[model samples]
Target chain A: MKEFNLIQRYFTPASLAPDTLLGVGDDAAIIQPPAHQHLAVCVDTLVAGVHFPKDTHPRDIGHKALAVNLSDLAAMAATPRWATLALTLPEHDDTWLTAFADGFHTLAREHGVDLIGGDTTRGPLTITVQVMGHVPPDQALRRDGARPGDHILVTSTLGDAALALAQWDHPNPAPTLRARLTRPTPRIAAGHILRGRAHAGIDISDGLVQDLGHVLKASGMGATLQAGALPLSEAFRHAMGDGTNWQYPLAGGDDYELLFTLGEADVEPIREQLAGQGCPATVIGRIEAEPGLRVLGPDGAPLTLEQGGYSHFGN
Target chain B: MKEFNLIQRYFTPASLAPDTLLGVGDDAAIIQPPAHQHLAVCVDTLVAGVHFPKDTHPRDIGHKALAVNLSDLAAMAATPRWATLALTLPEHDDTWLTAFADGFHTLAREHGVDLIGGDTTRGPLTITVQVMGHVPPDQALRRDGARPGDHILVTSTLGDAALALAQWDHPNPAPTLRARLTRPTPRIAAGHILRGRAHAGIDISDGLVQDLGHVLKASGMGATLQAGALPLSEAFRHAMGDGTNWQYPLAGGDDYELLFTLGEADVEPIREQLAGQGCPATVIGRIEAEPGLRVLGPDGAPLTLEQGGYSHFGN
Candidate 1:
């Protein structure tokens, strides 16, 4: 199939939002921005082998590609409106395209995002998704608002993705663990609830310690994360017997959970709000007046990790 | 260097536009869209070897990546605003990054575009740029407005870039020709002038014939072009004595010029306005009531080209 036909057949779905003025076949998609709102924009790229295993499902690749970008918008407490994809594939595969589009459109419909525009080219497999959304200017969550004595919280359990990756090549890998790595849930509802409640926010893609480090650095504050307080899923705890695999949650990457800071007085209320929405929030750390990160072990002593987090290039 | 540090050092230039509330460092950039305007968004991807030769300069790659996306925005008659880049590189090279950033930022500054936010990852060389701009809702140019009697116009020359590619492997290619292929100028100014006057518009990145075919298909009109009226640059004419190579202009891709349609009455005024801005336009054809494209040779008879245009997959 030709480039235009492929895009039309696979990516162009009926518009879900009314704000898209000119979608898909145009040189550019014209979108009507809602009045009195700030537009949140983010782009993320996923390479075939670098970001996921070569044997990964095409549907999963498509899902993860959009999921990661939406996670960024979720970090900013933005409601997704539109997304443009730039997909480079080795060649046109009908089955692959169908499955990929199914996965992408499924999540996009759930979030009410329109696939407005995209480009398809011939090359090694690579997917770049740019998601645009809107958030109230006054209520947009940022990473520079953390204050001393604020409680740092996260949505859902962490490190399940990393643990899944570790067992990806195993003969009998758990399907639930694999699902966590391949299809991450963007915490859009959690982000919406934390908009006015959370002082600072970031999505934990590069593990808790490193992602939290970004929040601390941006806010110019320190943080103390309780090792025992880091929520682990039953799957993770059962797989990691003896319950001492702190590195996965601390320094492992690819967790699409939201990490935010709430004022001490607002923590319980925000947590209850998130729980009511089916996504529970856990207070794993607290912001401090100092300017460095420290993790308290189960016994309440300082703990150091062998490695920080996943960086594209080694530091 | 780590991914974050590389982005900070190279891609994170000081913000130029005041509308950017948050840029570069955040999970997502926050921008305040101007009221009473429709946002135009588009994305384009460039892969090494597929889009450009492997030996192409890093600076050229960077310039072309942004230029192509800007051309799409230009086609929509949108004033350029913010852009997000998703760059996947094979490895870190300091010199390449410096030159690439210089080329990218230079063009971005010229167009008053801010590098709002992006993601950097390690993989085969690929660059995906998503650009967002704005235009008055009523004045936004589209590909579906051409009338039966409208005149088809194109900005600047068409085949220079294609001719440059033809001579790319020569011992000493012309610098001007090489520049045309490497850094074709985007017709943002022409697009601005065509906003309220043009019937339909598109960028000639996939050759004039193919790109104009899109306009015809969308507008539900046919077109007849005078092959002799196709504008050729002086260098192009000088290089080909007794020129009969119509394929270069008709079927060659990578010409980042605007191909638009204007009513008979608006033609001269729009041409003068564009020429006043230092970009000249040519009347190549006229829209017809028929439903197919026809090219008349200098002898006034119909001409048939060997190929239609470049497609990602062979037709």
Candidate 2:
């Protein structure tokens, strides 16, 4: 199919948000955002070999591309509204585009995100998604708000996505773990519940340690993690086979979980609230008066990690 | 520098919009858009070889990437406010980045646009810019409002960029034409002026004939162009060094001028208004009750176009 036809057939139909004053088909889309709300915007890019392994399924690629961007909204405690996609493809394959559109629209519809506007081109496979959301004034979660002595917490399990990646070359990886890796859920609802509760929040796209380090740097604070307290799922254990491999979850990237910090006093009630929303929360550590992150072993001894988290550039 | 460090040094500094409640450092940028206005959003991508010749100056690449997106806002008669840059590079090149950022910020500062948020990755070189703008409610120019008796107009001149491209292999191309090809200006001022004066508007990115067809299709109208009325620039004429080479302007593209349709009686005043803004407008045609675009030659006979315009798919 031609580029214009492909978009008209697959994308134009899905851009039906009532607040979208103007959707696809124009040079730019016009949106009438609700009054008294600030707009939150972000953009993310995924390269075939660099971000994901080559030859990944088109559906998975589409899902993960938008999923990672939506995760940013979840981190900001904003409600996702609209997304624009820029896709560069090596070739035009109807089957690939059909499945990719299915994957993208499925996730977008769930979050009420409308396909507002975008551009398509001929090049190496790369997907860039810019998502816009709305957050009530003074209600957005920020990385700069982590106070010393605050309790650090995370939503859902960690390390499963990383472990699933490790099993990529295996003959048969656990379905649950693989889903965690390729179809990682964005914790939007958890974000909403934690909006007024959490002091700071960040999505763990680049591992828990590295991403949390951002919150620490932004807040000018430190943190101490209880390694045993990190949530590990049964699927992760099955994928790893034997001993504890905290490194995979702690330092491995693409987890897409929420790593947040809250006041010491507000933790229990917020935990209950999130659990009621089907997103259980776990207390991992506490923000410290010092200026670096440290993880304590089960015996309460300091555990040294080879690296904090993944970096596109070697640290 | 690492990806994070590169962004901090080069990108974070460009985010200075006071209305940008949150800028580059956060999970996503937050902006308190002025109340009572609609948000205009647009995205565009530039691939290394496909969008431009390989090894084009990084500054020109950056300028065009943002310029193209800004052009979309111009077409919509919107005031650009913020932009997110998603850059993919094969490797870290500090000098290239410095030049690119200089070029990007030069235009951004001119338009009061801030670089809010983005992602960087290692991959084939690509730059995707998503621009957000604002237009007052009921004041946006749309493509669907052209009338049968409306006059079609284009800002500045057409075909210079396309003509410059035709001279790409020439040893001594006109510097003026070269600049038009490399740095086509977005007629934002013209668009703003036409917000209320024009019935419909669009940018001439995809050749005049084809792009105007979109306006016609959207407005459910047809048009007739007096071939002698097509605006031709002296630089384009100097580049071509021939008589009546109308194809370059009529079917060639990368012209970021605002092509708008207006009521016949309103054309002269609007043209005078645009001229006062230093963007002279030209009346090129008129909307008709017919259902297809027709161009009349000096001989008063309809001319046949070999092709309507450039398409990603071969015609």
Candidate 3:
């Protein structure tokens, strides 16, 4: 297969946005950004064996590659408008390329994101996606805006993806847990709802404690997380019946849920708004003037954690 | 080294663009696109052993990674602005990373481009760069804009990089030819000069014939090239004394020169304009109403090319 033929066959999906002046088959994609909006740009790379199991499905790889980048836009309260993919593969497999394109385009169409441009090369399996979106300049959620006494909230649940990884060698892993690992949802609509409301925001891709610590450090504040208030999915709870695997939620990575901060008065309203969208928002911590992260157990005593988070280089 | 520490220490160069509202350390980098301009977005991936030799210098790899994407922008006649990188490496080597960053930042600083956001992962070495620039919506040089009888032109010379690659294992490759291979300049200034003047444009990354074929196909036209008119650098001419290696310029890849078409009347003015900027432009072909590309030898006889261009998957 020629590089041009491969791209035209698998990657050049029709544009969905009117602002895309030119899409694929050009030197670069030309886009007209809507006036009064700031462009939010992000890039993420997922390497085989490091980010996913080597045997992971090509469809899942495609889905997760875009999902993680969209999660970043969600944290910024940006509406994803376009994405460019740089895909590296060891060999040309027709079935794999078809499935990968299907997975990528399925999510892209769902989010109204145009597959504007991309580069496909031959190498070890590595997928890099750069997503571009827009948000009102003043309303863009940032990590440096958290204030003292603000409430730290999270969308949906965590630990399912981590649990899926831990049980990968099991005879039968739960489909719900495995799905969380392969197809984590980006809280884009929830991000839009949080715009102009949340003081600070970040996507929990690197565990709750580690990602929240970033917010605290960036905003020059501290946080007290209530371990009892941490949200867990039904499947997660059932899988870990004794609740001994708290580290999966607290320190394990790859959740893709939004962790955000807001004032106490707006919590109920924001929660209700998110509930209307079929997503639940839970208050698990509060920002403090002191400058360190603390986790409180159900008995109201500080609990120390053994691990910080998943670091790419730490291992 | 932790991922965050690695990013902070090596990749987080301070912003040089005021419009970069929020840079690295955020969920996404935020930038205000100047009003009345369309954004040009492009991405390119370079794999070790595929795009460059396994032993290529880290600095040249970094420079070329960004340069190739900038060449895409140049072909679109866009002014470079911001870039996001997604790098995959097998491990952390401080010396390699520092040299790579120096190379990337050197070109970036020279072009007034800001490093806005990026991701670093552990894998076989691969670099993907996404560059965003601004071009007026009406003035972008696109491939589909050529007309019959438009004179085809190219900036600087070609075949030097191809020659250098052929002599890579030699004990002493010509320094000029090696630099052309390792540090091919993007015709950004020449692109600016071609905007609103050139009817169709493309960057010659995948050989002159293949890339020019793109322009012809997009414009629904053809071209006739004169073999004697193809520009050759002093290094290239001296290296190939008898000029038997015509395939090096016609079918060899990695030249990064701008290939464009303009009216015959505007040819001299455009060539003079480019020459004033220290880049020479040569008229090598003319667009034709007929629908196939043809190359003429020195005796006015047609010449056949043995190869098309570089293809990632063809091998």
Candidate 4:
């Protein structure tokens, strides 16, 4: 098939959102940003074998590519509006393209984010997603907003992706854990709720400790995370046996959940509200004036970690 | 070195444009788009060996990655503003990073597009650039706007890049021709000038024949081309041996010049004005109500070519 023919066959059927004035066929997509709102833009790249295992399904790759970008928007309290995908494939495989498009179309429909314009090239498998979103003036959640004494919280359960990763070699693994690893949800709605309410935010694509460190560093503050309070899922606990596997929740990455902060006076109400919206937010730490991440054990002592996060370059 | 540290050391030095509310390091970059202007977004990916030669310089790779995206914006008559780069490298090489960033920074500075947010990863070389620009309502140039009897025009010269490609294996080559091949200038000024004047527009990434096909398909029109009227550079003629190498201008790709259509009345004056702006427009064809491209040879007879243009998956 021709390049245009391939794109039209696989990527054209997905419905476009109203904000996209002109879609894929145009040189550039024209997007109507809402009045008085700023456009929040971010790009994320996932390389096969490096970012995901080579055996990973094409549909999961498609879902994760856009999800990671949506996670970025959620971290900024921006409502995803449109996306452009630069997809580099090994070759034109009809079966893979169909499954990939299906995965992409499903999540995009749920978020109402249109795939506007992008390019497809022949190469080793790599997917890059550039997501655009809108945030009302002064309502965006920023990393620098976290102040000393602010309470840090995370949405949903932690370490499920890592738990699934640890069980990758197992012939039969828990389906819940595998789903978390392959198709983690981006908490865009929670991000919308936290706007003007959450002091700082970041998505936990990296480890909770590492990502929170980003929030701390950007805010000129530090964080003291409570190990006992980490919302590690029951599936993760059962999968890892009775032994404490704090490392999974603390240092393992790939959980696309939201890690944010709220002030003392604002924490409870917003937490309840987000919980009502199906995202259970658990307060796990407090921001401090000095810089550094201090993860406390259940007995309130500083815990030692063999790894901080999944560093792309470092072992 | 850590991935974050590498990014900070190399990719973070460039000064941001004032419109960038948040530049790299944040979860997402927040840009304050100009009021009443719609965001024009486009993404382009350059994979090593596919988009450019595997032996191509890292600097050229960097330049072309972003240049292609800028070309898309130029086709839309949008003012280039901000860009996010998703860079996937096989490994962290400091020398290559410095050269790549230098090339990227130079073009980005020239275009006044700030590097806002993106991710770097470990993988095969692939540079995906997503560019966002601003276009005033109803003023954005579109491919679907061509009308019957509209005069088709192209900016600058064509076939130089293709000629250069043909001579890639020559022992010695012209420096200027090589630059044309490796670094085609995006015709942003031409797009800007053509706004409200040109009826339809497209960038010559996929050659005159194929890209014009896009315009005709979108506009529900056809085109009749004058093969001899094609603005093939004199340098191209001198470089080629005596042969009917008209396919260089007719079917070769990656020229990065603007191909557009304007009403017969609106053509001349705008052509003169664009010439003053350093982009000389040449009318090579005319839009017809019928569908399909017909190229007339210098002998005033219809010309037939085996290939229309470069298709990644086709001959």
Residue B269: error of model 4 in Å? 0.7
Q: Which docking category, incorrect, acceptable, medium or high, applies to candidate 4?
A: medium
Candidate 2 per-residue lDDT over residues A71-101, each given as its tens digit: 9999999999999988888887889998888
lDDT tens per residue, model 3, B169-278:
98999999999989979889999999999999999999999999889999999989998899998999998987558899998889999999999899999999999999
Candidate 1 lDDT for residue A175: 84
**Please, what is the whole-model Cα lDDT of each candidate in the order they appear?**
0.89, 0.85, 0.89, 0.85
Q: How would you encode candidate 1's per-residue C-alpha lDDT over B77-170 as one tens digit per residue?
A: 9999998888888899999999999889999999999998888898888998889999998798899999999999999888888888989899
Consecutive 10-residue window with the lowest summed lDDT within model 1 chain B: B1-10
Per-residue error (Å), model 4, residue A224: 1.8
DockQ by candidate, in order: 0.66, 0.62, 0.66, 0.63
lDDT of 4 by residue, B64-134 (tens): 88888899999999999998888888888888998898888888888888888778888888888889899
True contacts kept of each: 0.82, 0.76, 0.84, 0.81
Writing each residue's lDDT as its tens digit, candidate 3 over A79-173 gives 99999988898889999999999889999998989988888898888998999999998888999999999999999998899999999888999
Q: What clash count does candidate 3 reach?
A: 0
Sort by TM-score, top down from the best: 1, 3, 2, 4
TM-score of each: 0.98, 0.97, 0.98, 0.97
Residue B110 C-alpha lDDT in model 1 = 94
Candidate 4: where is the Cα deviation over 4 Å? A1-3, B1-4
User: What does candidate 2's lDDT look like per residue over B139-242, in tens digits?
Assistant: 88888899998999999988888888877878997889879878879889888998877999988887899889989999999999988887788776665665
